[model samples]
Target: MIELGKVEYYLLAINVIGAVVYLINMFLYRHTSNGQINVIVTITFLLGGSAGMLLMMLFFDRKAVKENMMSRVFVICIFIIQIIILLIYKGHHAEHVTFAFWKFFADHRMLLIYFGIMNLVTFIVFAIDKVNARAHRSRIRIVTLLGLLFAGGSIGGLISMYLFRHKTQKDYFTVGMPLIIIMQIVVIFYVMNAGW
Candidate 1:
């Protein structure tokens, strides 16, 4: 069994809780004003979240996603479909509310910027770690990597992990990283629906 630290467990729990809560809220009367729209978004999240988590888990189990060209193409296709569906849903809903996108962006731009910067930094850190490993040099601290990933650099962290072929075998990155991404997505979903 892969032993996860307390923090990893906490993050995983938060991810499941957040997604479930957000999904429940989406079905409530107050939140489900746009019935069809809400259904689309809800389904997308349910499917996307489940698929994403499954893929990550598969990677954690050492399935060698990188080794098989066909598997890589299939996974990429699924990921692209998920992104497309999410974008379409967001764009559709944006049209209903006047300047919703702008308002949301304006209010949460700082957070978005922070997430973006942190992800980039985290990706660079992971890439550097991979280089160091290859060169047999000193390495970045595990705590530092975990800290960055928890602080909203998850998407970047995962991207770097896969891109650099670094840390993919570790339970922390494979499992914990997906959990973080799910939590972040839930938070973003909540903030978008929350009227300013």
Candidate 2:
């Protein structure tokens, strides 16, 4: 088991506080401007670490996640910085650090499973939407499709779009799907290469 030191513990505490603040703002305060909220959230994310902020963005404020590209990029950058710090610390304490790609896979098996399931679901939803479109039935909402794509289903979404010949004309899907895929790929590569 990895033991967290004082700095890590303090960072965790700050992250928890930041998450609480984010929740309160999301649930109780409706008067704040989007820009103001973004600034506050970004600052907290930077100071406290990004895992909590990312979870909040993914689960609580997906609309902002979808719309605020700059904030998303900033959060991702913060996450990268956190990873770099971890790598540097591990380098200093090399005896305690044993990193490999397979080790990462083993450690994060559940996350991989979640992604796999999400991708399958995204594909099915896209297929259903296409069938509905052909049958002149109620169509799936674009937001739902985009949400799935954003939530670790970009690969499935891209395949479905091409296989089903659906939503190909929409610039958002054509552009955004690939962009998300690229971003995901870059992050994965960075993690895989960080120490392994």
Candidate 3:
């Protein structure tokens, strides 16, 4: 049997509660434009990926169901922006959010790599899905994005999804996202026990 540590336990508890809160908020405010608010976007930014897209959608253009020249440009721009934001993470205003927490957390660079890989994978998978046209293009891009996220690299995927609106909501996300978080906990357990 797996035992949860205090930190992992608290993290898990917070995630579950956050999900519930997001669900409740979605049901309550689904129709409202509250998602446009930066604070609201930031709060769920990592979990939902809305923060990045909120601005684009408000300022640039909406994502259409079909692919076109403009859609290609949009995807390209989103990916580039994700890369920029991630590369600039060290200098972000959020750095001061918790100078102390940085000491305990794993290397931010490794985590950033994890995120970048997930989003890149999501992009490839999404492209392949568009070509297949078999029971596809149902927002599972978000799932692939978040699945990779759960697998470790969620921050990158999270940011990508927000900008791309890849896997906003879907059955895959419902299951895979939580599993990713759980896997991280398992890895943490192993690391702590393996004489790290």
Best by TM-score: 2
The best candidate in terms of lDDT: 2
lDDT digits (tens) for residues 1-196 of candidate 3:
9887674464455445444443444344445655524344335434334323443443444433222222222323333344334334424333223333234355546754665676577556654544444545453443344445545554444445446555456434434444444545444433333322
Model 2's lDDT to the true fold? Answer: 0.72
Worst 10 residues of 1 by lDDT: 65-74
Off by over 4 Å in 2: 1-103, 190-196
Off by over 4 Å in 3: 1-116, 119-147
Deviation from native of the Cα of residue 121 in model 1, angstroms:
0.3
* Candidate number that wins on TM-score, 1 or 3: 1
lDDT of 2 by residue, 1-196 (tens): 9998987897788778677767765664455554245567757777855777777768877774333544555565566566566656656333343436567667889878888998999999999999999999999988788778878898889899999999898766777777667667656655665544
| lDDT (tens digit, per residue) of candidate 1 on 1-196 | 9898774565466445434543444345244554434344335434454344334434442333332322222333344445545555545333333435567667778887998899999999999999999999999977578678868888899999999899988766676677667655655654565343
Report lDDT (CA) for all predictions: 0.60, 0.72, 0.43
Q: Residue 135 deviation, candidate 3, in Å?
A: 15
